[model samples]
Target: MDGDKSLFAWVVENYKDGHLICDDQSGETADFLHISASSRTLSFIHVKKSGSSSEQRKISASAHEVVIGQAVKNLIWMDFTALRTRLESPPIEEPACWNSGVKGSDRSAFLAAFDRRDATSRTEIIIVQPHVREAHYKHLHENGLDHEQISEDTLRLHLLEGLLNAARSTTTSVGADLFIIGSSD
Candidate 1:
């Protein structure tokens, strides 16, 4: 599989069971959104590729900034009402891409999964990078992010603890949660 497909598959597999994953194909939406029916969690993931030279390795500072910007942009667009409307009437050109089967039965299940009102109660923004390093984090801290903007929840920095934990889980290479910004409430 190509890089994009591989990354999407990895995300679906790593999210564990009881999660409904869908591709946010609209250019206006994030790359993907994962909804946990049991937990009532809604998470948006923005997958970004590092510069060609940095592929499979640490991301460049500029690339990292771009990823963060996209995350913030998606978060701002993640209005619960808007999301519900979009899900209910998904774009005609954009079809649902469940992690599992794509049969008629799957379509019924997908619609049911998205029909719940609880899924949009909580929100998370995850930036999936190929890899990351301590310097990258430090750089983001020093320059990429604005504390004032974050405090206002404009970028959802408060919900980033999970992403930080994920990043810290591996020292040698950052996994899925490279840069996460999340809603506090």
Candidate 2:
């Protein structure tokens, strides 16, 4: 994908079995809200892109901050009641989210799943950004303590990791999972 919009489309398409109840790429709501009946899980997906494809190999603290902020700020909408309200009556006219693949029957079934969901049902906040490379994040997760101040990029990576950790902690407290979809490079 070239950017966040494309990434959002790809994610929604790839999630074959789930119902994409929300697809608000205009910043008015979550980028994507999905529910999987069989998995009994709901997901809030937020997408962010680096400055350029070349930047994908580098960790951008600013990018992470913006994406994570979006994810954390929208946590209040995780409630089933709030989602139902949005589903029934969108805040704007001709909302793109409401015109998605979800049908009336699908919404009803998903709503039933939401209502009957217990402690076993799971929720997730996903931050999809190509700014942070997977290997770099893993290295920081593993040998971060040993490396003293290496470079500006390293410092930025550390800051990004810290932000991710804090966001994860906040989501965990609310009984949701937090994770990053960083670059494979």
Candidate 3:
């Protein structure tokens, strides 16, 4: 479950109980979409895996570029109306991205519940990057001091931290939350 696809599947399996989980991995949408009608929440999940050990230890700005970019760029899809329309008629035919979970009659009910939700509904962009160890982020911020003798990894993590902060700020401005889920190490 460490890989991107596996982690996505894991989310579907574990969180699909009371949610309309959509595996919209197509380039057109988020990697996975979780809609909880009861909670009135929609989560757009983007996933990425570390290519190297160093990347797993600290946030790699280059490695995160695509995932973060996708999360930000697809903010237009955060609308319930747009999402319902897209889900009602997905563009891709072969290997459909929104193929799994809450299909057929169930999808209608899910969409109905979604439509019932109001402006207070919460939406969030979740970036699940195991590559970015949480410890590195906390240490860098908590122990902020002279970076004169900082290692390459620390510098890169700092850069990625800045990027994540900027993304968070931007997401917040639009009445959405931006969450970066990294390893608790």
Candidate 4:
């Protein structure tokens, strides 16, 4: 994640077309959904990002903590500085995360709900993106890169970006959200 926005492409590539479900009962390890409907469409669940203190506590205690790259070490072996440079310099068509000022929080509960194997498989991706801090955006502006022209999706993209940008060896596991896909397999 390097805290940069340009590195989001990789995250998107990795996550798209994958199965998403919540672990309502903490049953089986989550798996890919290679069945009908074939991901007909996707939507966002945007939540107002304020009073972050409670939000932080909620996510930290979430049943599943998506661990990336063998461990949290994914934060390491990263060129965050270089990533930042590219994000501000190119002023790519895609907006950088710095604009929204939303911090990354866990999306486990949303998935945990999917882990359930009952009649009501209710729950959808709630694109809860937080706003980026003003300071990060200020730093980008001072870099001589004019990103003021671009829009802001700083929050939703954080998770997607992280998934896309993660190294191949990196694995994102929602152990707490695992439930059997079918009656058997």
lDDT of 1 by residue, 53-155 (tens): 3422333344455656666555544466676665656555445455342212233454465556353355556677554444544545576565544432223
Clashing residue pairs for model 3: none
Clashing pairs in 1: none
Error of 3 at 119 (Å): 0.8
Candidate 3, residues 155-182, lDDT tens digits: the string is 7877887888988887888789998877
Clashes found in each candidate (C-alpha, N, C closer than 3 A): 0, 0, 0, 25
Better of 1 and 3 by TM-score: 3
lDDT per residue (tens digit) for residues 1-185 in model 2: 23555776667565546566555645444687667757867778888876667634666778888888888988887676776676666555544332134333334544555667677888889888887777877776677657665766678777877888999988898889987887876
Angstrom error of the Cα, residue 70, model 1: value is 1.8
After TM-score superposition, what is the CA distance of residue 106 in candidate 1 from its true location, in Å?
A: 6.6
Model 4 stretches astray by more than 4 angstroms: 1-21, 25-168, 171-185
Q: At residue 2, give the lDDT of candidate 2.
A: 38
Q: Please report, in order, the local distance difference test score of every candidate based on alpha carbons.
A: 0.50, 0.70, 0.68, 0.27
Between prediction 2 and prediction 4, the one with superior TM-score is 2
lDDT of residue 47 for candidate 2: 83
Q: Count backbone clashes in candidate 4.
A: 25
lDDT of 1 at 60: 39
Regions of model 2 farther than 4 Å from truth: 1-5, 25-29, 92-113, 139-149
lDDT agreement of model 1 with the native: 0.50
